[model samples]
Target: MTEIRWLEAFVAVAEELHFGRAALRLHTSQSPLSQTIRKLENDLGTRLFERNTRSVALTSAGHALLPRAYRVLQDMRLAREAALAEVEGVRGKILIGFSGAVNHLTLPPLTRAVRRRHPDIELDLTSRVRTRDGLASVANGTLDLAFVGVAESPDPSVVARLVAREEIGAVLPLDHPLAREKSIPLQSLAGDDFISPPTDGSSSMTEVLLASCMAAGFRPRIVQELSDPYMVLTFVAAGVGVTLMSSGISSIIPSGATYVPLDAPHHYMNHAIAWSADNDSAVLKAVLDVVEEVFPPVAS
Candidate 1:
């Protein structure tokens, strides 16, 4: 039978890189630690370490197994905690974070679904922040989960699940000639200054927008770096510059601005739920289960 201790041992040794230190950390002796690791390697048919009297190092297979070991331990911890919380009749609180981009569409239904399913689980939603901030909070355990707008997760400790995808369009001043068209070629705005949300890893939309522009043969000259989505639109409305935005948010467009679909095909702004890989809170699992029920993740 498979045992969790084997993974725990592997992780401890992989992190410490010295069997003596790892054994000390695990409150066990070096001989037993070496035996456990050897058994693990035999079962897996791979040498996890290359060792000598002077030094010990991870083999390529060991490096590969490290992350998987962390994930397994984390999952086990979550299962155990969740089961205990249930047995103890503990009602838990979960803190949720959201980026401005996902606030309109994703949060409302998700909140309703969570409430409907896990009424005993308290959900505390944070104010609108950027995807980067939400991701950072989740990774640090300050928030349990977050709905964010990003193409990919920036941190290894944080995981992102795609929950929504929407067509992207140009946010232009109402009087801009291109705004009159039903669809605008992205390159048409090549020479125009842009008002964009911060591209400093705060939002994944910034990456999508920049990539789209580069593909269209021009780099956007951003005049402002507002972190707020509405603020970016406000600047575009005031003729500061134009920007790329999700078409689903066109309803919130300020009166002075218009959203025109980009002629580019299949490009979209993505929304994802992010959480710490190590978070073992039962409340978090409950909320995540609700997310899975209400909004199945987009197939990769």
Candidate 2:
């Protein structure tokens, strides 16, 4: 059977038209180079070159085969590079999921960094996935990675790397009595009705709210549970009730609502990049490397 070295020898000699010069180009002794070419000619049943002590030239068969041989060598090089690129995590498609404020605050920089560093890798982003759903997708291999709001992933099959932790704060109607305070104690709002998002099994804003309120020795009376955070804020603005939220999302507080940081012994909501522990994807690792560079984990 034909081999790659045989093709290399043939191309080098065909191009140089001199066995000695081709051997130097190939970093091999002329004798082996000549033998390789002879083996290739014998395999093909054709004389590819005609040579005498004084000169060397390609036979008609060699002239016809030169371009084809060149293509074979070039294609082999490209094939090896493609394989290496995949092995090195520099190429492939990654499915990434994002949700809530992390979609704006954390995802952008990570996405940009991945794009810049691994331009050949394709990123397919799915937005608005909640923490639990994102975690589920990642664990099941549907999503290669997910940016979510959670101190740590509750899913045992996944690993979460903390990206950013923002202090928990309260959003109240601008006219609410506690809004007057620049910062409010968590227990101070226990008497007020609250509006919040519904809690799921995973770490979520509602979990944070309930935990913070309980830590402060009161149960928040959530009068309404809404899925859309903006709508929940709108309810707060309408004087429906107050809600606890991460300061990272404070920017979206409606005009009628005011955000006040929760007083001392600050509670924080965490954003993390989660991936399945089972997934050892090189592309995912490449993206995670960029995540580390962009948002290194901080002490929580």
Candidate 3:
């Protein structure tokens, strides 16, 4: 039964504690503002302010109503924003995924950029996803965008754009013999146990590692498989085995581990931004625009 304007007038007077100042703050005449506050007190059956010619102060009832009235105004503003966001589509929900290796390199910057520019958009980010699963998620609408590392073409229903590249390197313990080399040869690691890449079958790093090893006349013996670069490097540092990683994660190399470049015929990891061709969300379009601006597509 209470009107919003009455509450607004009450709150302004309650805060300023002066009818004339509160009227100026509300851009209304002091008498009308005072009348509105008096009406609000009558409706509530309690005095909301204690006043004299010198100054004004809050009554016990006024103190209680102040916070409640402010909250009502806040809720109304939020509700209005929610309606506007739904209509514009810029504030709609978006799911973004990334494999672990590229999450460190790309997700951080991309997440920051999107949040800064489109603060209303809901962003959901998942890390350590397999390239195959991430691509599948995009096609099915479970994901709006995915940062994947690929060695071959993705599904026909999706578009893959090369956004970044990193030369593959051997991740080895500092104490390992190969770690001291200026540039380690792929074949030299053929005998060591390896932390294989994601088994998702779409990992270009795994393909390159196996193919490079085969070209050296031997295949790597997989001792373990890890989806996270940091985890994979942890095992390497523990002497569990040596593994291949992209130079992009070199900064995250843990203590007792280091990254050494691969010699001639060096393998590289191609990081691509992939999304379904079926996606028509305006929020998705805005994200793609930012993606292209941050990491422009590389010429094929």
Candidate 4:
């Protein structure tokens, strides 16, 4: 079979339309360039060019092959560039799993930082509330990392880094009587209808709120359960019922909903970055750097 060199020579001669010019462009002698073209034609079992005393012209086969050869060369160049980019940490995809609530405050800054620093990296951000599923996705190599809220310790197989502590608060309609108070006592809402996340949603904030209410000597009369924090907030704004949410969610508070800080001991929800202990992803590291920059821990 003819080598790539033969294709190059044939392409050059067919483009230049002169053996001498093609030889000069290839930095070789006319005799060798002509030989290469002849060799390519023989390999393909077809004539690619016709030569006259004064000028050279492409045969029908050469005309058909020219565009295909150019496309092949372009594709090869792009493939090489993509491989080089991956090696240089300038390209590739990273999957990030996060909670719906975190998207209200954390994702905007994180996304901007990633775009500003590593524009070539593709970020596939997914909002999921199941901590076990999120952790398993990272552990089994489906996700690069996850931003999760955990009341207890993380799985031993996963590496966890504390990102930020978001204070838990009560979300009430602005026109509600409780909105006038600077802080709402959890016990006061005992008899009122409460909106909460689904038990199966694995929301740490919901667990914290439920526990806080219990500690304060009353069980919340949960009127409805939802999965999406924004939807929960929307329901509260529409005067369906009130719910507990992270202070970070205040950033996206509905027009008619007011966020009041909890008093005394009910302060914050622990949020963290979790990934598989086996993962050594540069992209994930880049994401963590941004998170640290945006929400650095206060020293004691």
What RMSD, rounded to one decimal, does every model reach?
10.5, 20.5, 16.7, 17.8
Model 3 alpha-carbon drift over 4 Å, by segment: 1-89, 151-154, 200-202
Off by over 4 Å in 2: 1-89, 151-155
TM-score of each: 0.68, 0.66, 0.69, 0.66
Model 3: per-residue Cα lDDT over 6-101, one tens digit each = 978887787678899899988989998888888888888998888889989999998888767766664454455467667674676678888775
Q: What TM-score would candidate 4 get against the native?
A: 0.66
Q: What is the C-alpha lDDT of each candidate?
A: 0.82, 0.81, 0.79, 0.74
Off by over 4 Å in 4: 1-87, 151-154, 298-300
- Candidate 4 residue 128 C-alpha distance from true site, Å: 3.5
Q: Which is the winner by TM-score between candidate 1 and candidate 2?
A: 1
Better of 1 and 2 by lDDT: 1
* Candidate 4 Cα deviation (angstroms), residue 240: 1.5
Given candidate 2, what's the lDDT at residue 84?
A: 72
Task: Tell me the lDDT of candidate 3.
Answer: 0.79
Residue pairs in candidate 1 whose N, alpha carbon or C atoms collide under 3 angstroms: none
